[model samples]
Target chain A: MASSSEPSALPTLLVFRVRELRFLAALRERYRVLDFFTSGSPLAAFLAAAAGGADPPRALVTVGGDSVRVDAALLDAVPSLRFVHSTGAGLDHIDLGECARRGVGVASSGTVYSTDVADHAVGLLVDVLRRVSAADRFVRRGLWPLHGDYPLGSKLGGKRVGIIGLGNIGTLIAKRLAAFGCVICYSSRKPKESVSYWYFPSVHDLASESDVLVVACALTRETRHIVNKDVLAALGKDGVVVNIGRGPNIDEAELVAALKEGRIAGASLDVFDKEPKVPAELFSMDNVVLTHHVAVFTTESRSDLRDVTISNLEAFFAGRPLLNPVLHS
Target chain B: MASSSEPSALPTLLVFRVRELRFLAALRERYRVLDFFTSGSPLAAFLAAAAGGADPPRALVTVGGDSVRVDAALLDAVPSLRFVHSTGAGLDHIDLGECARRGVGVASSGTVYSTDVADHAVGLLVDVLRRVSAADRFVRRGLWPLHGDYPLGSKLGGKRVGIIGLGNIGTLIAKRLAAFGCVICYSSRKPKESVSYWYFPSVHDLASESDVLVVACALTRETRHIVNKDVLAALGKDGVVVNIGRGPNIDEAELVAALKEGRIAGASLDVFDKEPKVPAELFSMDNVVLTHHVAVFTTESRSDLRDVTISNLEAFFAGRPLLNPVLHS
Candidate 1:
């Protein structure tokens, strides 16, 4: 593709898989844009060609949520790559260790989506506990007059809420629920010194004591299937589950079984084990609320994400510290 | 009704239309119960017969959903009635002025249901704003795999939320939403000296400035239809309305029209204008979430209501102050 503007003067900026038009247009104004998806070639072939070019791209933008992998192979293919910006909050898709080894910097979406995800976590929790969705369905079906009264929802004020990854999103969820008079506790990799709430060592221990389990952790090797059969069983018959993180955080099969057998009271899931493909069993259950991975996709958050991503890209090119840097552990 | 225990010596406790079996069983252990529904006579006839009896009831328990009216006619028929304990938090059905004129003390359900109602109010607000019910419906209908991304929900943080009542329930709702970073404002009959939230003198003014209007006030002559067409129009196209108070607080026809015409964004209503007979138009709309008047009827609140009402009766009979007294203005 040819451009109308002088193509070589601006700093070269490569963009991988994700294509948000407004964000793309903004980036195009500042840089000689190299979008891999629009290159009419494979990502590997395009990256190899760009890397060997006279004006090699030192920075690129990609998506998180495991949609694209930025591992050693991709890093090696683009030798000039010094910075990577992920549009998603989670960096599980990117090989952080590989980037760290190569002395490359990374910026995630940061606290931009935290407030929106936390808002959704609370929304899902309240919907499950108070049966808001169920009640809405009852009224929509015109059952109120015939049925006399819909089943009473449980009170939410004094529930013991256990948050599974107490990072930015989990902390925000805690702060919101604390105002609703919920007792908050957490099971992080280790206890956060700044947080005053009670801490448990493991998911099982936390689940045993909690009335609700809100999963807001990142998806990693140790964290995958964190909320399995034992944890669900420990949560007991009246337990509620809310997941705003990745689908793989909890064992979906076990969760579906637990919900089916009435081992747990209910669940509100925004992410599923498979993208777009939700469990068929969940389609018929009223005890669970399922959304198509939209906890952080609010219109407000989208605008913020675009702005933050643009800022991250601009800051990297200026050799300033990244606005939303991610730590590689 | 004849009983196995001595009935004549016990203090007669007349009961109105609410029939919670567990609460009734608990009440039976304390007072000589006289149920109007089970008395085999019209309420007027039953009141006349009980008034002329040798052992007159000095106290009675009733409900406050306008299901039973404890007005001048009933008060005149039962001259011996000294106190009334309404099982519902609302006291609109009970004529406070008539009770005050006859020196009859009134005990409402009080703060027992306040927390529950506030929880529901926040739940409904979050559900409506985030489209939790709509998203749930989408996933349940096997639309996720086919439709890809569901429509995005609006963010709750930074929203200007105007509370209509700002009473016990309204205050709690304000407190909960404040933690989510919402700007709290309110419209009440008069400005509250203790409340620090921004106050508007009229619903129209509040609607003009707010993105969300939460209705948590009582149903009185002055308050009925307080959220009329003009107020709704002022709330604009993106404003959300949450009603956990009473149905008539909003003009139902006007609300349906506003929703249909896209004058407002959406609504999450626990109470409706006609209640059991909700507008059929709302049934098909995804923007509105309707529940059949069960906001405060949680299992936990029900138990609390039972205990509070029983305590109020015990206090009245023992010549002690009522536990949940309503001030007559």
Candidate 2:
């Protein structure tokens, strides 16, 4: 850590780009944020200048979902980097193994987006069960008068909801749905103690018992295509699925096929295997409710993320333990 | 009351039309439902036949939102009718005062739809605040790739939610939202003791202090158009309005203008001033969500309504009090 003797001169922070200027200004109060993307110079020239600076940046700040790949090659360019801070909960874009090997500390915006994501999950579930978006479309196209009464939707009360990954976001989803009188069960890497919710060891088992299957687990090698054909089949023809986690958490092709064949009653998806490119088949299906990957993009959550990122940076520079450190692999 | 000498013969139930045959079948086990619309004979002939029958229909069963107007003229035609059973909530089409004057007992599907409507209210609120329906439209139009990020939405937690009525449905909505960490306030005809939620005497004052205003009151002469221009103005530009109550409870014209002028952030309306008719202005606005008055039409709720209606009829015929009597003036 830098000595306290020169308290007036703030530490340098290397950033690729920032979405919010206010957040940048907040960070600038405590650090000299060197933004490579915003600086009016060639990329090679900026990197060369940054490499040759008198005080090399020791901390790198990044926003999640920016497709910012922080691998060994990028780390090699910034040899002085000792800490990586992500302004979002997702660590998919960050090379955690590389950071662990390099002895770099990692801090994430822990649980800041959890509530928003959980709320969106519940919203999507309710939309699917209540046919909110479909009914909206029916009303928008002036179909209500043409078609007398809109079809009856299913109720959320008494539904058996199976949540995949009973983590921070999933736990909150369970809590909110419980208040709506939904029966909650979950499948996770391991059964958590002290939690009274029923637990299933496998995703298929959980799906077979649930009227609604919610995917809220993080995307990983083992969890890829976690909700595949078998899980969808188990969920049955009357079951619905809601995905708020990473897109690849469920097999997009399988999900599309299941919905098309009426193997599943409906689906409400916020993420796709390849985002920004959803299957065209889902567009016309009234049973499906589709949204962009925005389960966490809320104003309040973004501000909370900004504060968390800044706090992590302050703690690192102040020689204190990071508030939310990602453990080494 | 008829003696139970003929055990196989069912009590006669008068009806105009039945939307759900399942509900009709459920009621058929207990009562002989006389169908006027489906009888293949003219209405006048059916009524004349029924009036001349030895066992004239003594109870009238109706479905809510069917706009089945039961007026004094209709009641006078069936002089033997002693009970009017609504298979759904909302007695808007039925003249309660006339029924009271005629000494006709009224039984509604009381509290059977309370949970479903409450769930829908919260669903609409979440959809509005999070822009779920709008985001779905954006994704369906294949704009996610063209537009890198959808706009951020507001969080439900920490927002002040004001309910128009603290009755069964409204109170359930408060309980569900309270679990989401929202602060709850309410406005009703009278403040009940032993309740802890903050109470506002008037809806205008409630709107002034709330971030989200939910219309959950019943439709009555005094409650009609309760949320007018002043209430909309008090809700302000950032406030959202979610109406799961009757449509006339709000001024639809003022609501449309307020939304057009950005007087309020957004609205999610399940009921309209006119059934099957919505303002064309709301069709293009992404800030609003419109549904076809389906807050209480869930399959589970409908089944519950059938049970409640049957129970009420059975109780009335067995010389006991109606299960859910709507006390009249």
Candidate 3:
């Protein structure tokens, strides 16, 4: 809990990360902005913010990558900091237990990333199902016959698509696929209510039956390695898998093996365990499509995330309840 | 009209202009087991079919490219020929007016082409908006950091997308774009009553208002060159254009001028005025994406079309009304 500090001081805000310069500039306009930094300088930025003079920020707004144990220590030192708001959908970054013990509030940019993530997921779906990328490459490389000729491309309609999570992004994916006349089934932690889609109780069950399996669930302890070699094998030779969720949810080594051995037809991945340093082996194969963890990076989502972060900071400063509060329990 | 002759006296069905041999083989399963010939010699095939005294096919099926005038003339001599089914969406080849004048019913693969065309349109949308093809090319060619950072990708949401036609393919494209959260408007010869999308009274109006102008309308005297230099200029520098309609619908020469002069941001085209001969200039530009006219060539759509063509043949043999009869007014 924040101590009874002097009431005369203006509230300074720590802008930890943002997608672009405009977001930070916009935040500065509405608040008494202090130090602005990113996760790249985790230790330095934290130490500097903690030792800053009398009017240090009363809240820290973090974005980009996740922070760990080292960040938690610096977070505790700043007695003036009473709340933390993440500029992302996932809450895997902050040390929620310690924050709860210290009576600090946490909020996340939850639904803001939904539309962007859904966009990328659908793009991947269309890419693989239609073989657009491959066919385009073939034609651009001058491989097309003088009289057009090639293997027929696949279609999205009537294909059995299984969604791993039924959260905001997954639900939107289902709605989008429904318009294409696909049979959408889902397997979540708990089946959603008021939906006509068939629900499978487990991931393997979904994999075994679905023509394409999409992972849109969050990363949690229980979800680690949820899509392993066994799941890939269950999906069989004609099945395609796409992971828009966290990388660890899918076993990377298993995925590479499954694709190479033809246990699964193909895969599209937007997240990796070690991002930006995606496995070079994954790139060599034509069956796999790769994207750096940028499924949530779109112009609209970036601005919406900034708005959500700033609004959370405002509510925290005004002592009103924070919107999209991330319960530490 | 086919000359007066007995049904049993008709020759075998001459299959001509089959672009893909696999599609021909698939369709042949429905026809009488007899001698077959390709587009290489329409006269030889027609003579062979006519001389066969028994087990006559009673009609001709043309697949692949436009049916040649020579093939039509040879088939015109067959007295027992009841109808002609072209396994294509467009009727530019079969001379619908001539067929109608001769009292022969003409049927075509109509809505069967929607899935592939819709998929292609979406592919072009993604390619232009996300600049995926360019980015992929950059990554493959190791041309990263030309701008010293990640390539900029546009958001599909909140953009005004104008579709030029509202036919089966255009409506299918509309359904897919609806999920992308885009504001949809379209210009058609006549307004559709089922959809409530904003309608622009003119192509020029649609171009001026749209962030992305898409060509999905048919090619006719009325629509030819509708998206010329003026429409391209109205789209402005930040706008993108995609064409899945026939190549002539856009003035290819003027489009080349607009793209070269940076009148519009970029374009993705699946068809050209002289296909398989895309402008060398378009190949050199980073702002343009090109593909062979394989928009309606997906496996799902191919099989669906094959089934429809077979059904049309069966119905013609049974002397019933054709499902998608194309006729001249």
Candidate 4:
């Protein structure tokens, strides 16, 4: 929506596959809008819509659907695109090199979901460490073991936390866990200059050392299955694994096997390789906690995210710097 | 239990109930111990054991049992009693008037379970507020909603927390939740001499004004069922209830009806009126997160509690004052 006093010189925005529709709708006055509804195949339809228009939109915003290959086609269709905003946090889509070579700026929602993801990480940590989810089930089932003369439970404080990919969300998680009195350490490609956490140069060293290993890094060719069989074996019997970044970072099959064999204590996952297709084995296990990919959908965050996206778009159209520009790999 | 160099004046404990038995057995040293073996009349068995002893110890310790009311019988049996220690935090079980009148010093475990109970409160808050158990079960049962869309969850930050009692565990919970950026208000019989918190003179006033109502007060004649139907109703539809103190504080049937009819959002409970006898109606509900009163059984707290209890016993036997002396109620 444009301000009445200052008529928006905003270029039209062709937002396709926007999961947060209400957020974008609030920005209608600020830009000449064209929302095309397409679930997985927005490329063909988006081209048709752009061609029929009087002038193509200077920018396009879409969610990550089919890998970065799909984004290559999107870049070709919108040649006049000066800026492309990926609605997702991880830029696993949107071929960064294609945009970089074309001088087309790309922006992603970076720190918008940091707080929510951090909260989810802590929730998962406590859920597994405290065995809260199991206790929740036990009480409802009339099977409270502690009350039945068997008391066994643990706390999360004074434990070592190993974070993979000490990015925005990881740092936020470190801060929150620090408040709970956990010893924080991390293993990144390279140590972050800002944090003074104990840095292990490799994932294996981190897995062996940490009492809890949290995956909060980007999903990439290098990171895929970084927490595989060897890593799980390295984590040993008393370690917990919490993943919020992506599913492929930890091999699910290996994780299930590790859990079954007591190679690792437990895991709490928010992101699965296949959405809504978690294994039944994990369902029956006491050591696993799974939440659907709804970490970023808090009521407050939903509204704030929409506003942040609109502000990013406004800056781009007004020749101002974008808030979270996507860096090409 | 005493070391070779230390005096052997420590009390010989006689525990009658399961919780007390577990707590007493955890002591590092072996004091002359007598374990009661009776189902219906544990206190009678405890009295029988105390009477049969050849000589009285320096002190007698009891946890939760009918043994508290049998104090006169115990003092009659053991005329050498200089002190009595209760394993449980509260001293309601001990006949404090008789102890004071008889010149017997009484001690209770103070604040040992504070962090454990507080951690459980935070876990329960997150579990119910985020609807974790419900979401967890949904995914496990292969009943993930077709659209992967469910009820939205709320953030703990910016919410108002009303503490019913501001004693040891309550203060700890306040400090912990404050880290999450919540507004903490409390209601106590006699408000502390110095504390920075919004105070409510009555439970209804606290219920009406807060988003979350937590009951952490001791179960007493005045506090029993204090959070009755009126208090629950005062909390209204969006309020969440968490009880780590005792179940009788809430009228169970009223809480069930309120939750069933959406008069309140949800609740998380640790203690129940009947041990191992949760209501069948609450079994299928996702709004409630139930635990078996094991919040104080964390690994760190358990070890710490043992060390503190033994130290207190040692101190008392060494002609030193009790660390956490229990005053007559």
> Could you tell me the lDDT of residue A207 within candidate 2?
96
lDDT per residue, candidate 2, A1-329, as tens digits? 22212344779888767767788889878887778767766655655566667777889898656445778877887778889898766788788999999988989889999999999999999999999999899999999989655678999989999999999999999999999999999999999895899999999999999999999998888899999999999999999999998888898999999999999999999888886788999999999999888888889987898889889888888889999989421
All models: lDDT?
Answer: 0.86, 0.86, 0.74, 0.76
Among incorrect, acceptable, medium and high, the docking class of model 4 is acceptable
**Model 4 over residues B1-329: C-alpha lDDT tens digits?**
11222345445655444344455566425575544533244565546546555544556666642335536767776666777767665565777777888888887888887777887887788778777767777787777646555776677778899999999889888877776667999999977767798999899999999999999998888898888899999999999999988777788889988988999999888877665667778887878888777777677776777777777777777778778877421
Between candidates 1 and 3, which one is better according to lDDT?
A: 1
In the range A1-329, model 3's lDDT, one tens digit per residue, is: 12113343446676654547787788757765554344244555554644465676667777644433314675656766777788766766677777887777888887888877787787778776666666667667676656544666667888899999888899988988887778999998887887989999999999999999999998878888899988888899999988889888899888888888888888877777755446667656656666656677666677677788778877877777778888532
Q: Which number leads on lDDT?
A: 2
Over 4 Å off, model 3: A1-10, A17-19, A29-49, A66-71, A77-79, A145-149, B1-11, B26-58, B64-82, B135-148, B284-287
Clashing residue pairs, backbone N/CA/C < 3 A, model 3 = A153-B299, B11-B49
The reply for model 2, stretches above 4 Å from the true place, is: A1-10, A28-31, A36-49, A52-54, A327-329, B1-10, B27-32, B39-54, B327-329
What DockQ would you assign to candidate 1?
0.80
RMSD of each: 2.9, 4.3, 5.0, 5.2
lDDT of 1 by residue, A1-329 (tens): 33313446888888876666777888888888888778887777788778877688888788865365889998989989999888877888888999999988888888988998899889899888888898888888878778655567888888999999899899999999999889999999889999899999989999999999999999999999999999999999999999998999999999999989999999999998877788898878877888777788788998898889889888888877788887421
Per-residue lDDT, model 4, residue B295, is: 76
True contacts kept of 3: 0.41
What TM-score, over all chains together, does every model reach?
A: 0.93, 0.92, 0.87, 0.86
RMSD of 2: 4.3
Error of 1 at B271 (Å): 1.0
Span of 10 residues, lowest total lDDT, candidate 3 chain A: A1-10
lDDT of 1: 0.86
